[model samples]
Target: MSFLSFSPCCVKGGILPGVPRGDYDTSTLKKVGGYHVNSSDGMIGDGKVALVIFADIFGLQVPNCQILADGFSDELKCHVFVPDYIPNPPPNSAFTQVAKTFPEEYANRPWYISLIEWIKTIFKAWKWIPTFLFQGNQIRLAQAAVDNLITEGYTTIMSIGYCRGATILEYLLSSSSNVIQCAVLCHPEPKPRLYNHINRPTIWNIPDHDTFFKSNEVDILKRIMGKKVKDQGLEFECFVHKDTVHGFANRPTLDHEATKIAFEKVNNDAIEFFKRHLLQ
Candidate 1:
């Protein structure tokens, strides 16, 4: 099986700096059309175009993901829905433990020791097993969410996915579905089987320093997508962020100014892509 199908790297990076816990305002949560969506102050726009944000392993409950959804809603002037496809969200306590201990542990121990500890933190049952078993189900749920949004008067829809969710979105885009007009995938796992099935305009946000996908692997993807786009008359674009790591879009280390800028630029670029494709 390809690393994209079921790799431990798919489950990595559940924890990041500045993710919120219990203090997140539930008032910003509500069912938009038929799916539970998080938007700025729970606001839902009346625009014909809508965005579906397929969240990372942290699911819709993560503050950063919610904030990104809200940001998309405001920036695109479109109704954005973040559905919880992962029924059992990875435990916050496990990530919290890592966040609390990583810095001090890294300072005191060998670099390999800290790396081992970080691996131990993310390689939990909730992260890996459910991802393998329910990836297809996530695709179905995302399609259903988009269908519901269409029923609610959205004439066109676009999707954005992060990490494992990006893999699911790849499936969604490849499937014979017409509800989603275009898609943006961030740090997606490489699935060669589905690449041939993508017929719509798509954008891939590739990080320069991803551990899961090495430079050669990214080059292969670029070659494949580039050839396919030309041969099939499909629109495909890739943005490789320099000085970035995996999961920087949603799970950014905000302390780094470069990471912050990368996130904003990618977010804006995605919105503009949707505006060009979905709104026009």
Candidate 2:
């Protein structure tokens, strides 16, 4: 079963407090070995470590995603690249307008129409058709970006994925010959099979109130991860943010103090995890 939650609330976009509300600075955007990268100079050491950010469905063009990418570069003092997996991503205005009306529009659909759509979905599923077939293309694009970074002399590569992007990262990690050294998954849509195959150190930032992973689901994942930790001595860390919801890390509900606290805490934890695994 797919772990992805196609909830309207999950897709509803908003900007977090303290984050800038526009595109990344022009100076930060440059070509690195034939790949566009948002780089941060003046790294503390001589290590050639870099972070690849696989953004959520909103894609790399979203201001919140860009802000988070820039924040990671600034915090880690390393080169960060947010590849344009969606070449012609929807603009912010369009996304925001849709997000605002999606719930009401969905509710207003005729019952027969909804039933027909459900039947079509079931038929597609029965035929083994992938719901997010476009993800295959995104994976290839992300791989190219990673390969480009390696060509530019990066020795170690760490990945940070949000939402749908997390599934892509998990696919890479589960592959038999991926070069990703470590990963940080924020509000991931982790498949059950991933727990058994992940070899590298991973930090999972799970929101306690996630619509996709309820308490029982989270317990099952914890048990699976716990077994892996015990049997393989893997460094699979899971941090469940109390009183938090999905998208809290990137687009936190700033009105809530707990969400704000969880956002900062998760960011700090991810930074520390990267330092321990990749920088040291």
Candidate 3:
């Protein structure tokens, strides 16, 4: 999913997606400048704040991410942008090949068929080498998207990343300062080491069994992000959603009760986190 690695967990997480709430409307959105824009034009506030969503590998195509973006815009009455920062997001067919063939998702398939599919998946991964190697391009494209927003008169810019997109956001925020005001990472890709620097207020919406992060790794992220920043008001805090999988927040498994509840809670928490760190 990321430029660094092909995450099987991310592939499996894309199998079954949950439905977005009926009230979260996104009927009029169209791609503009390589991104989808959601806005309310200051219906509730001054509309000076802009939120950027670095979506999962599915990017702009994922319904859950789109709905979540709409929910943020509708709730906050601000501008929200979902940028396609990377190219050739592995298709649903790829996820199907990887997930259905994997034992965790389907145990009833014939061994020979599974083996064939597994081999095919391996070949697919090798083909993805070019995609992962383009992280630099992804960052450049993402940076331009954020910079363009700032140029458009948005005073406060906040961002959230899901899955592989989180990996990119981590690098973006670590390398640049004073760009994003605050952040919420939903099911972020967990790294083994601390980032070079994290200067913005960030919250991690961690799932019980993260697709990318292990328990100890999540603890490590908590420790790294939990450190209090001088005068940032709200510091890094990781909210663990219990009894859920890695993509429970962004690519919900519609049948699971826990997934639904966690999705709502994560969205609400993110909205509140953004509000608390307003530049005004």
The per-residue C-alpha lDDT of model 2 at residue 13 equals 45
Per-candidate TM-scores read 0.76, 0.72, 0.77
Worst 10 residues of 1 by lDDT: 1-10
Candidate 2: regions farther than 4 A off: 1-13, 16-41, 45-47, 87-133
Model 1: CA > 4 A from native? 1-46, 92-112, 115-128, 132-134
lDDT of 3 by residue, 105-148 (tens): 45566789878988887776667666655677777777777887
Clashing pairs for model 3 are 3-132
> TM-score ranking from best to worst?
3, 1, 2
Residue-level lDDT for 219 in candidate 2: 77
